[model samples]
Target: MNIPDPQTFTDPEKLRKLMANAVRLGYEDLAFNCKLRIAEIAGAAQDDVIEREFWTALIAAEEFKAAAAGKTSRLAKIRTKHRRVGAQRLLADMMMEEAVSDGFETLVAHGRAELTCEAIVLRHEDQFSVDAVNAARKKLMDHGVAMTDIAA
Candidate 1:
C-alpha cells in the first residue's frame, strides 16, 4: 500500500484506509513509520491535527495487538469478542481481562502489551493519563520483571 506523506495528507479517511491496509498486509515497518509521523504531528497546535494523530496512534496500537496475538486460538477469541465490544474499548479492556485470567507468564506478557498500547497513545496524545502505563509497569514489576527491563 502506498502510504501518503503523513504531514501532507489532508484527507483523514484516506489516511485511515492506507493505515488499515498497511496493518492488514502485515507491514512490519508501519508502526515505526507511523510513530515517526505521529511524533512530528505531535508538535502541531491545531486540534484537528491532534485528533488525526490520535486515530493514527490507535491504528498502530491495533497493529501491535495483532502482531503480539499472532495466529493463536487466543487471537481468534479476541476477534470474536472485538466484534461484540468494539475495537477501541476491547484493546484497553482485553489486557486487564487477560492479565487476571491467565497465568503469571501470560500476565507479564499482557502487562507489557498494555504498557506498549498506553505508551503509544500517550506519545501521540499527551491529554491521555499516564496512570494506565504506570499500572501496567507496576504489574510487570510485581511479576518480577525489572523496571529497566520494562523500559527496554
Candidate 2:
C-alpha cells in the first residue's frame, strides 16, 4: 500500500481517504503504522487534538474491518500489558544508548536524527512515553541538530 506523505496529514479529507483505502485493502498493519507515524509527527507539531482524532478513527476503522471479517483487531494484539514502573525508563535509556553507539552524530550530520528518533519511538511505543521521545528529539536539537532538516 502507498502510505500518504506525512505532510499530507494536516488535510483531514486526504488522511481519511488514505485510511479508507488501507481498510479496504485489509492492510490493518499499514493503517496502524500510519497512526504511529502520525503520533510522532503530531508530537513534533504539538498538535495532540489531530493526533487523537486520527488515532481514534483509524482504530475504529480497523476494528470495524476486523469484526466484519470475523477476526481480531490487529490493534488489540499489538497493545502490550501494563509494565512495572521504571521499565519504560529503562527501555528509553537503552534505546538512547544504542542510538549513540550507532553513530548518531553521523545520522545528525546527514539530517536523519529526527526520523531516526521517530522510528525508535514507534518501534517501541509500548515501552516508551511520548515525553521521553520528545526529550530525546529536543536534546538532539539543543546540540545543534536540526529536527526538521530532512523530510520523512
Candidate 3:
C-alpha cells in the first residue's frame, strides 16, 4: 500500500486523493462539497494557480471551526482557542491575495450568508471589531444579493 505524502497540500492531484480518502472513510458529505468547491477554483487559468493553496487553507480553517463547534464538551474546549487562532491566521494570509480579496468582495455582495460572513471577517481582520463584522453582515443581509455572480 502506498501512503500519500502529507506535505502535498498545494498539489491538486494529492488534495483530490486525500479528499477521496476522507469520503471513503465515511466523511462523504463534508469532503465532497469541499472537493467540488476546490475543483471550481482549480479549473481556472494556469496563471491563477495560487487559488488552489489559498482555497485549501480556507477550507481547512472552516473545518477547524466546525471541529471546534463539536458537541462533545471536553473535546470542543480542548485547544479550541489555539485552533481558532490557527484558522484566523490561515484566513488572514488568504486575504492578502488579490484574487481572494476580489472574491471576498464579490461574496459579500452576492454569496450566501455563511460565505459572506466569512468574507467580511477575512476582509476586515485586525482593523475591525467583532461588532463591526456583525454590523457588516447585518447590512449585507438587509441589502440582499444584487451583484453579478462570478464563476469560480
Tens-digit lDDT string for candidate 3 (58-104): 34334433433542122232135336654344444333333333333
Per model, state how many residue pairs clash.
0, 0, 0
Query: What overall lDDT goes with each candidate model?
Result: 0.44, 0.46, 0.42
Q: Where is model 3 poorest over a 10-residue stretch in terms of lDDT?
A: 70-79
Off by over 4 Å in 1: 1-72, 84-88, 95-98, 101-104, 107-128
Residue 143 miss distance in model 1 (angstroms): 0.8
3 Cα displacement, candidate 1 (Å) = 34
- lDDT computed for candidate 2: 0.46
TM-scores of all candidate predictions against the true structure? 0.32, 0.29, 0.27
Q: Please give the distance, in angstroms, between residue 2's alpha carbon in candidate 1 and its true position after superposition.
A: 36
Question: How good is model 2 by TM-score?
Answer: 0.29
Error of 3 at 9 (Å): 1.5
Clashing pairs in model 1? none
Ranking by TM-score: 1, 2, 3
Q: After superposition, how far is residue 92 of candidate 2 from its true place, in Å?
A: 2.7
Q: Tens digits of per-residue lDDT for model 1 on 117-152?
A: 333333333433355445445555556666554331
Tens-place lDDT per residue, model 2, 1-152, is: 45556355764445556656776888765554554444444345434432333233334344344435556444332123112323234336534552442223434543445334333444345556676666566556566765455234
